[model samples]
Target: MNIAELKEDLISYSKTIGIDKIGFTTASTFDGLRNRLVKQQELNYQSGFEEPDIEKRVNPSLLLDRPQSIISIALAYPTKMSKRVTSKKGERRGIFCRASWGEDYHYVLKDRLNKLEAYLQEKVPDVQLKSMVDTGELSDRAVAERAGIGWSGKNCSIITPEFGSYVYLGETITNIPFETDEPMEDRCGSCNKCIDACPTGALVQGGQLDAKRCIAFLTQTKGFLAEEFRVELGNRIYGCDTCQTVCPENKGKDFHFHKEMEPEPEVVKPLLKPILHLSNREFKDKFGSLSGSWRGKKPIQRNAIIALAHFKDETAIEDLTILLTSDPRPVIRGTAAWSLGKIGGDGAKTALQHAIDMEQDEEVRVEITKGLQLIEE
Candidate 1:
């Protein structure tokens, strides 16, 4: 079998199947990424959502028997919504990040990977291949970078020359000795845009992130968000895109190549007040297809309360009061208490004062106190 010919054929096949970009690299261990990950761990900057085993994350050999090469693919997603949701007076909406704008990228990328895998299987019946999207052990960014799909940008995203950083990445490890592509040169010379644009200062430095401080990570947390991050979250209910949105490389780079990757403006940016009252099934039915909904509704609801506070939506005061006084979840009740304080008014202050007396949870009580303090000042 001519490996080079097969590689070219695979590239052609990829274009037909909606893969925006494709590249290959040797299945060597990602030594540089491993070192950086270790440093991140030592500094306690790890998000805790990643695969715990660093070996499995950087070493493709561990994942597949005698892995020879890795094929990386990138699919560009639209940065701007083609259609706009008509804005009404006093109506506040919360936004999911661009990455979560379309159908959950995990499913979309996996579908493409599965197709690539089938193509390889047809060519070489005994090919051993292991495919993974974001949730997999392998770091998609690192794989994409080494595979020449894109260069690792300062914001820690794979910035393809054609698609900027607005691309979804996936990879497949196989025992085929495919020809590899050359890695791209870093073009982010002295550009501090993404680092400076991070609302929570999550970008500790170029190519390094303190996940704990990242609004993207914070938005996904299922617990009470620390008071410091509440203000930083603004209207971002799911993931934060400030870093990507500010990148110069991403300028004028919106692509709607895949129909599945297009954003439904109304769904991605929904009314914050309505999100506060969604039943679990209703939440799933509306947002289940989007990747932002993976953490379930609690975090989104909590962020929505904070967003309402950010907007000082007098209209949502009633809704916030309901959550503060009667919500079963302590985090939701507590977050609502803080937001009420931030959105100070006679009614909000009254609700906070009443909740302080009836609230049993110490944390919720503390939030209520904070709310009252904001109103007082």
Candidate 2:
């Protein structure tokens, strides 16, 4: 079988099945990425959500027997919402990052990978293949870089020239020998837009990231946000896109190529007050389909309270009071107490004062004390 011909046919089939970009590379060890991961670990900068084994993450040969080549695919998601939610006066909203705006990209990418896998299987009767999406052992960014799909940008994202960084990446490691594409040159040059725009200065320098300080990483944690980074979160509930949004390569690079990748205006940017009151089932029914909802509703709710505080939303004072006084989760109650103090309404101050006396949890009590302090100042 001619490997070159098979590669050509696969590329053609990829377009018919909605894969925006595809590339191939030898299944070699990722030396640079391995070193970077070690350094990131030493600095305690990793998000802790990554595959823990550095060997599995950087060495494709370890994942599949006789791994000869890896095929990387990129599906571009829309950066701009085609539809807009009509927000009323005094109505505040919290935003999920663009990556989570659409259907859970994991499913979308996996479906495409399945199709590619099937195609390869039919062509090579005994094809040994392993496909992976975001949660896979291998770093999708590193695979995409080696596969020539895009260059690793300063913000630590794969920046494709055609789609910018708003692309979902997936990969298939195969035993079949295939021709590889040359990797793209780094176009970022000396431009520091993404690094300069990071809200928490998470982009420490160029390609390095301090995930501990990254708002994108912080918003996903299912616990009380440290007071230091709470203000940096702004209206973000799920992930941060500041670095990508500010990139010169991403300028006006919105693409609605795939229908499944389209953002529903209300879902991506939901009303802050409604989010604070969502029952677990209601939250699941509304947000279960989106990737941002994976961490469940607690984190989103906590962030919503902070976003309300960011706006000093007098209207949400009632809801914040309810959360502060009776919410089961200490994080929610504590955050509500903090938000009430930040908003500073007459009733909000009253609620905080009452919470100080009734709250049993020491952490919640501390938040209540802080809220009272804000009211005093």
Candidate 3:
């Protein structure tokens, strides 16, 4: 079999199917990422969402038998919403980060990879192959970087020159020994913009991230957000984009390449107050299709309450009061108590007084006291 001809044919076929960028690399062990992940584990910096087995994550051979090559694909997502959401007075909205804007990227990228897999199977009969997206054991960014899809940016995203960092990544492992592509050069030299712009200083320094301090990671946690970081959560409901937005490389880099990646203005930036009352069914119906809903509605609703406080939206007081006074979940009740303090007013104080009187959870009571203290301050 002519390997060069096969690779050329594969690359040609990829663009026909809407793959924004594609690259190939040998399935050698990822030496650098193994060390970094181990160090991250040692430092207690991992987000806990990562696959626990380090060996399976770093070595493609562990994932696929006799893995000879890996293919990395990137699909560009839009940065700018074509239809702008009208901002009205009093009703505040919470923003989802760019990555979670559209139909869950997992399905979109998987659809693309499935097509590529079928094409490869037809080309090389009995070809051994495996594919994975973000939820899989492999680090999408690491695979993309080593496969020449893009460079590892300071924000920890693969920044392709053609598509910037606003791209969803996926990979396929195969036994075919295709020619590998050269990795891109790191372009963030002396560009301290992303590091300086992290809301919680989560990007500790350069390319390293303290995931516990990251707003994106924080937004996904089911527990009560820490007071210090809750103040830093700003208006982000699902994820944080401060680092990516501040990066110079991403300037003028919006690409609406795929319809699946297009953001619905109202859906991605929904009103903060309305989210506070969504039933499980309602939340699933509205946001289930997006990537942000992976952790379910609790984290999103909790973040939305914090976002309402960021806006100091008095309009949400009634909704926040309901959650604090009667919500079944302690995390919801506690977070509502905190938002009440941040959005202090006569109504907020009344709600806090009511919560303090009837709250049963010890943690919820403490949050209620903190809320009252904020109002007094």
Clash tally, candidates in order: 0, 0, 0
Candidate 2 residues lying further than 4 Å off, grouped into runs, are 86-88
Task: Look at candidate 1 and tell me the lDDT of residue 340.
Answer: 88
Per-residue lDDT of candidate 3, residues 311-365 (tens digit): 8888889999999988999999999999999899999999899778887799999
lDDT measured at residue 238 in model 1 versus the true structure, 0 to 100: 91
- Give a tens-digit lDDT track for model 1, residues 124-193: 9999999999899999999999889889989999898899999999999999989889999999999999
TM-score per model over all chains: 0.99, 0.98, 0.98
Model 2 Cα lDDT, one tens digit per residue, 46-129:
999999999999998899998999999999999888778765558888899999977899999999999999999999989999
Model 1 lDDT, full chain set: 0.92
TM-score of 3: 0.98
Candidate 2 structure, TM-score to reference: 0.98
